[model samples]
Target: EFRDMKTEEPEVAPSPEKDKFEIIGKSTSRIDGEKIVTGRAPYTHDIKLRGMLYGKILRSPHACAEVISMDISQVQSLPGVKAAIQLKKGRVTYAGEQVAAVAAVDEKTAEQALKLIKVEYKSLPFAVTEEKAMEEGAPQVRKRPNVQKFNEYTRGNIDKGFKEADFVLENTYKTAVEIHHPAETHGSVAKWEGERLTVWDSTQAIFGVRDGLARALKIPASRIKVIKHYMGGGFGSKLGINDYTVAAAMLAKQANKPVKIILSRRENSLCVGNRPSSLQTIKGGVKKDGTLTALYLKNYTSGGIGRGDYCSEPVVDLYKCPNVQVEEHSVFTNTGASRPTRAPGHVQGTFALEGFLEELANKINLDPLELRKKNYSTKNQGDKETPYSSKGLNKCYQLGAEKIGWKRRNKRPGEGNGKVRRGLGVASQIWWGVGRAGTQADVKLHPDGSVEAICGTQDIGCGTRTYMATITAETLGLRPKDVTVKIGNTEYPWCGGSGGSTTTPSVAPAIRDAALKAADYLKKMAAENLEVKADDIIIGNRKFSN
Candidate 1:
């Protein structure tokens, strides 16, 4: 019923011809599969510390408002309440913004403390929809215009290219905002030891949180240890330091006890980041011979207070067209700032671009796949001169077409009518998945013959620990279960966040490097003992031979 596909784009820097891997290319179970399925694995939500207090935050109900008067003195005097603080002093950006926080002996007491704290806010005009935000004389989301142009790119002449075209097509596509509801809601457990802080968070980035917490608390990075051994999920929501984590830390410091804060499902929906909605219009021109002549895209996306998704990368890079133009705008609205969703801009952009291309192909009585093949690009993105060293997209298209029986697809839209219907469509996207040069890992060989591979990379529900064990064990001539993989800690060698599809590429190389170095060291030690050269040593099956 299913087929396993293997493919890759060549590495930027290829290594020497390597030996056949015993464990890597074989069928292997996840190293921690048992522990996870048996409920023995510890996640941030499962973490509990001694003298732990529950933290609760009071949030603004108004989408746009300025805090007029706030008092936490009553909350501070509440019985069983350990600490209380005013989180926001002036204007609140969005409805779920933290206005105040308190830590109490229990969840009931914490909830009671939030009710005792009173705050007054002056509500302001606001817009929550893209159409409403883009209207003229709209209530300002920020100092800048509500509809602010963020990106513009042009390659070759747009007018000339359109003039030369035989046929043209134009259409608009829209995507709604998407939210991440992980099995375990966002939470943090903070414990203080004098000036040092230790926080277990449900996050995708350990080092990022550590550095962020260090800056927020105005303490050295070395004093904060952020750990995330396991997390339910965080498509992109947990990539940075969250306000709740900071609130937990502050509460713990004031209470002189550990603090834990786990958000409710409602809180998760209101305050946490989500994928920004995109409205894109794509216009394209193609020749009679199925050659793409020009492409243009205008997109408007919203990210509340911050903007990051451009929604034009696919338009500029996914196809081969000399005359390409793109204009992107961020329509600010009163909502939670958008975080990077899985593939972020590419998802919306590709949907629009691919659908547009399909329409262009239908207009010319040509197959969509043939049109794509006709304009296959070798240059890097839209560059006229530069070339990517590795690209296997065309091959993928062929493999996919053959496997899915492309000929079975309908010739026109809505070609069939039935209670159950299936449609076959093809879509392609250009992704930049590469390693971070700054990523680092550590391999430690203990005196008792135990091995450990450590990094600050969070698991992010992606079997990071399993692959880490596999790589280290394969390199050191051991089994995956034999190598203890320790990750998700700031104390380990620093690694970048697990976003942008960079975790595997960034981490695999770093851990392999560390393991390879350890292997080389072992070779030298064995050769020195045997009075032989290091190159003559052979390592396999946990044995050294000369």
Candidate 2:
């Protein structure tokens, strides 16, 4: 339901007054602050269901192996083990790939049951590094070639632009693989009532989990409810329906009781996700006056069995280069698949691009800040000739430069000959922020003068509840504390999972739209009560008057 937020909204002309938000800019304590600090907030890890059995997954010890034979007979007959089932068959691609799962009276029993299950495997030669994977005779991780060129983008003539440049620079920048796990490891609690299922999960996407469970359990999505009122943090680790969650659901059905599966910290690090390593080589051409003539990026990244990020967006869209080209390849390795880590490709791309630009500026004896200002374009060069509706990047650059005392910096890079030195640097990033289309939310105003703003978007330890309440309250001329924000349950109106910097933009406007509609209804009621025209009525200070 969160993904189906598509409603064609006509563009609204920009308004300066409408853009200035008083309530939004102010600082306020989080609405859930007290509950969290007091240890009363119920996260998925803290949930305890009646008759709930603890579950644990058995994983392959080998990085690359083919299953010769599987035996879970001993685990099933083990005392206190409620249910045991195999999750994977045939070839295991990564080291921590799920092989089987066991549910028992407690986590210890479940772990012991897993140890009793025996599986035979034929270990296969595998490469786990990007460099080794790209080698000529390295072991193949997949059917396809280890190094596969999956993406390419080009605009204008590459050769012509390079020839037009006064100076050209080429260098290779490498970024190592980065793995960051959330404070709360991936987990789920599943309970079954007749044919219906309810899941308490620590996930970024609730509807995504519901749909995934439907696909996995062979049940209708309508019969499944996924709830995540709070999360420690996602960092892009928890996005869709994880296998452990499905295992819990299946175990619950088999054991005729609730099942809870929480991943260990080791499992979280091994299977959840990581930011893939990148070996990016950039060849850039620039004119004497800091004009970017051409830009070319060739990147090879590895995410184990996962798709690597397209680490060329910064080169293609960041500047006003006439000729730009990108060649991105994924070098498959035998390790945990990569997931979106924060900005994913952008962080790595920006580091490489920004560093290259600084070096490029040094070559031309131009200030890097001035070089950025000189090439600022209101039109997006990467997209199909679309002009930006609004861009405040240049203002940000000016303010940041001024605040950092840019004039006091050394004229050359690492030029000062002193034991201790202070330096200033500047960089910029393009963030694509907007509400996901079709995101729906509801505002309920009870006869008792209470308000509730409901959406399916989960707050991943961010102050989503506070802001939702603030938006609704401000719209209805009430205090932020007066309105209650309810979210993290699929039972609420549809909203997509909270990630890609979309939660606030997507959920806030939807709630605001509903709040505005409620305000309209209130104004109509007040006008009829006072025998005045609806348009003449005004709303402020929690009152409607003519």
CA lDDT, every model vs. true structure: 0.86, 0.86
lDDT (Cα, tens digit) per residue for candidate 1, span 20-50 = 6878867789888899999999998888887
- Give each model's clash number: 0, 5
In model 1, which regions exceed 4 Å deviation? 1-19, 383-385, 417-422
TM-score versus the correct structure, for each prediction: 0.95, 0.95
Candidate 1 differs from the real structure by a C-alpha RMSD in angstroms, to one decimal, of: 5.1
Per-residue CA lDDT of candidate 2, range 1-546, in tens? Answer: 111122543332232265555476688888889999999999999999888899999999998999988889998888899999989889998999999999999988999999998899999998888888888999999988998898899999999989999999998999988887788889999999999999999999999999999999898999999999778888888888898999999999999899999999999989989998888999999999999888999999888888888788788887888899899999999999999888889988998999999999999999999988877877786544788998888999988888889999889988787788777888878766577887888888888998888888899877899999988877778888898888998888888877889898888777777777777678788989999998788676787877
Error of 2 at 444 (Å): 1.3
Whole-model lDDT, candidate 1? 0.86
